[model samples]
Target: MSQATCPQCHAPFTPGQRFCPNCGKQISSTGEGVIPTVAASNSSLPPTMAANSNEGLPPTMAAGSNPNLPPVGNSNPNLPPTMAAEDPANHQQPYSQYASGAYTPPPPPSYNGYPGGTPTPNDPYAPPPPPGPGMYSMPPIPPKKKNSLPWIIGAVVVVLVLAVCGGSLYGITQLFSKKSTDNKTQTTTDNNNNGDNSNDTATKSVTLTNLAISYATDQITFTSIEQADQFPDDTYTKTYSYEKKSNFVRIHMKEKQEGGRSAYFSYSSAFSLILPDKTTIKALNAGEFSGPKEGEQRENWVDFETKKPVDLNSLVLRLGTAEEAQMEFPLKSNADLSEYLPKQADLNKAFNYGPMKWTLNTAIQRYDAPGAQAKKGKVFVIVSLTASNPSSSDFWGYDYIRLKSGDTTAAPEYTSDDDDLNDLSAGASNVKGTLIFQVPPSDTYTLVFASGKNLSGTNVTFSIK
Candidate 1:
């Protein structure tokens, strides 16, 4: 009951039948010519057969050689025609289906009639299809992002802040130092100007313009006062101020040459300071004109206007030589001792004294303290003495006193017994005593005494001058 298809008669035949039942054409068992005739029906059969048949085989006889095959030119009756509505002639065409805008998905194309293989060697220009939506893919690579503006801005801000702070600090420091220097300069200028105004009385109401104070000593020898100027008025013009205090004007006269060298003189000249009221303050007398010498002397004159003895707050002095006109006064380095001490003895001693001792403060003894200044030759001294009384008798005796030159506790040029009235009525009365020492301008003097009994107190404390 084998079934087959007739080649020419288009009739069915039993199995092993070698003849066409309808056309009576001989049928060969080789089955080769039968495939060529079937493939001839349409050349597009190759693509269809190539699409579904096994790889690398003749499609016709392979698919149609079945014993229960249908007649030639017959389609599969069981399969719906719409399932493969695509024309088989479209096979072997390049992009024909896609170019037509058809929605049908093309089969996976191959070569050599094999699965997942290359194109046929016979086709020269055959290349694979272009990439599709899902066909082509690449590894995912995320984008890169970078930002540095914030850090850069912050660094700029920091630099600006530091610069501002440093500049501000430096400016403040400079400003303070400048103000201090200006203040000092202004003060010095004001003082010098005031002193200059006080110097010239004729220019009193003239509003003193030149503000320079000059000084010269009497020890220097020069032909003229104008030629003896060491510190010229042109060099230092800065002014100075004076405090409100009593001052006796001190004058130092000296002689020198115009070239700054000291000179010896055979005779001296008279000098004085003329005030605004035509009152003359005599500086040097003709008796003092023996030789070229330098001497410092102070005047105890009271201001005619103030009626108080001038305690030397400021002075305007001038010196004249035999040949030259005059020169401004110069400043001296000597300390003002009048304000410090008010006694003639103390002043003289300060100018001519030595080391001293302190019984109370041992360390202060080695140094000398000028005693005091006296007004109208009156001086005060504070002394201390210690004594013992061993006998029960009240003796009538007095203590001896000495006034020595200089500050040493040595033998003095003047001595006197204590002028105490005798009180001889008790069993040793211990009493404290104080004495006053008056001396002229000898420039050096001190009070001392020998140890004796009946020395009452440990100290003799009182003011002198």
Candidate 2:
């Protein structure tokens, strides 16, 4: 008379009953006749109760149970055709057949040729169907993303930026370089122009056309200029003597006043002579000359001496400290003397002055003289000259004459023992005299005559050999 519990609903029932009356699930019994306690509902059952219940249950019941199993006669048509034809109601015969002890449970259905043990009506342990071609699988993992495009874009942007910066830098450098080059070129051009201007300033030329002479505070007029190779007898050396003799270049000039006032000129410190070599020669002796009256012009002479002969074609005469010259003259030299002394026969001819005619008669060598003694290494030479004045004015014979042999020159000697051609008054017929010079005994000599004291007049030369 013990009770058994229905496994699906946990309802109590008599042990001899084949099924539970409340839920209509089948029940089983063993030969032991042991009663089975009613279990709590499976939803509320403790883990110990569930495990203990498995111990006493049959192997078919212990495997599993299914709550969604079809009823005994209601098999699913969606199952396999073979499984759908097997009726579960056929296995549930009346319980009176099981009471005879000869009834046995049906074998479990075979799944793919594997024998499943005897199955309970609603077994939960049915093996799942084998996987077919329609089974779901995880989506293919997405390919790893690539970053090549972004890197390329970034590199391109960087290159463009660098190009722009480099262009800007190049432009700036080129601008500065061009500016510096222009500045240097301008500086060089300015320096060259300055150099050219300086050269032009240093080298300047002026012509000598109608130049006026100046002395101190007075303005003078330059009339004429001449040159001679010797000094006059009474002017420089009174006796025939040996000294450093030089040639003379003379200037004939005059000064004028607005009114009748007289002007004085110092010949020595007043003027200077610039030779062709640009050397300046100052006057050795200082003397004064008087100016002319208001309308009448008086003549004055200034003399400059040089040890060597110069370019007689061009000479520069400067007065005081002036950078510009007072006068320039085209003087004459021995090369230009052929116009006056045409031939050697003309040396003794009467050459006409403005109001006088003069001639060189003869030259004689004298070894000794009465009272005039020649210096140790020297001898004397006598020259005869004649002068005639036909005009009303007096012919003054105070002129420079000399005898030249090579670079040596001797002035005339004034001696009381010889006939001297002094000043001839107006209406004088003719006068003759002999002039003497002490010189070294050479094979050749030249007698040079100066018409004026400054040695600047009609000059004549006679070769004496």
Candidate 3:
């Protein structure tokens, strides 16, 4: 709104005027150039500002404003005046675009460091330049994820090893301890019995017979002697029943028999038993069985005069009807009597020792229908040993018993005879005196036992556990 004098040409012009009309020089705030200076006045000027102040000049003369003008006193006044150069408004300042460029941007105002172009000189809330990228570098990468699997595996392995070792040690300790304890118990038992003459209740005697009847052992008793001198070779009798249905024998003791107390008794005796088929079985050695001889019958006679190993394969004891049972136990009496007499060899074959003790072992063999070929669920009668003889006497003597109906010859595996009544045997006996049999599932059985001339009857009973 005002004009000032140009220092070079003494000419006045407005503030935006870049060159003086009379001379050539740049205008400055100091008014030291030929450019026109603005003058303050009350004069009303148009509010529109033209980008080129040269709009006031003719286009031809506008180009001539760039001037390193000669002095205003030059004689040639016909030439258009050259003015001083001025800054162009539309030109871009390259350095101003980037903060790092050569040009420095004006500092933000003092308050909060926000751009106000110029600072409030006394503002108290101004801040420094905002934090730079340098302050925000990423924190270093976190440590790799910690893996605990290896530690867990190691701990488990250690625990397993410890457990295995502990188990092995414990097993070894127990093994040794058990062996020592067994030896100690045996020693103590022997020491206590050193001079004792009383018979051991555990050591009992049992008589054996061949009866084809299924019978269950309810109670059994055996009598044992401390020495052979106490063994009695006396004649005795017992009753038993041969089951008609199961073809098994059930044995019972005679009330008059001294050893007949309940179903158990004690005795020490050995004898050779022979069947009707001439199957000579040694009932002496406690562990020997005799195989069926030629033409052997099922359950006929138990000769106490023959001692031979009995092979179970040679024997036949089958479940059959009462009518069929007779086929197995045919009644055959020797009219000549001398024809069936036992020989000296038979007497020698009698039980090797006497006054021996034995324990009975009874168990269920089979329980099925009645018939030589019956299905399951049918029952068989169980037969028990009623009496037996231990004397090695007359050669002509033989044992006789009645298996009136159901009867089965004892397998060699289930026969035994002990040598010393009060002492242990040399080996374990597979020959068990006690027998187990299954009768009709819901029925009972009966049998009988007797003595031969070569052996005296010693009544005794047996039972199941």
Among these predictions, the greatest lDDT belongs to 2
lDDT at 268 for candidate 1? Answer: 26
lDDT of 1 by residue, 1-465 (tens): 234565533455554334443343456645522444443345556764434333444222234444332324334333223223323343323124334653233233233222232343455677753444455546578787677999999999999999999999999999999799667645544554465533432221111222221122232321111101111222111111123322122232333222122223222232454433435454422323333222333211111121123212233343344333343332222322233222322221111011111221100110011211222322223233222233455535444444443343332112212233133333333333333343332333444533456443222222233
- Candidate 3 per-residue lDDT, tens place, 1-465, comes to 244665644555555454544343445432344223222222354322222334454332343342432222323232222312222232123212222354232233222222222223355554433444444445689989989999999999999999999999999999999799667645544533352312332211222222222211111111111111111221211111121111111111111211111211111121222343656333222111221222222221121221222221123222123322211221111112221111111111123223322322232323221112112433333332222333333122122222222343222121222222212234323233323233323222222334544435433232222
RMSD of 2: 29.8
Best by TM-score: 2
Could you tell me the lDDT of residue 32 within candidate 1?
21
Q: Candidate 2 on 133-181: residue-level lDDT in tens?
A: 5655467899998879989999999999999999999999999997996
Candidate 2: residue pairs that collide: none
Error of 1 at 169 (Å): 3.0
Write down the TM-score for model 2: 0.23
**Top-down lDDT ranking:** 2, 1, 3
Overlapping backbone residue pairs in candidate 3 total: 64
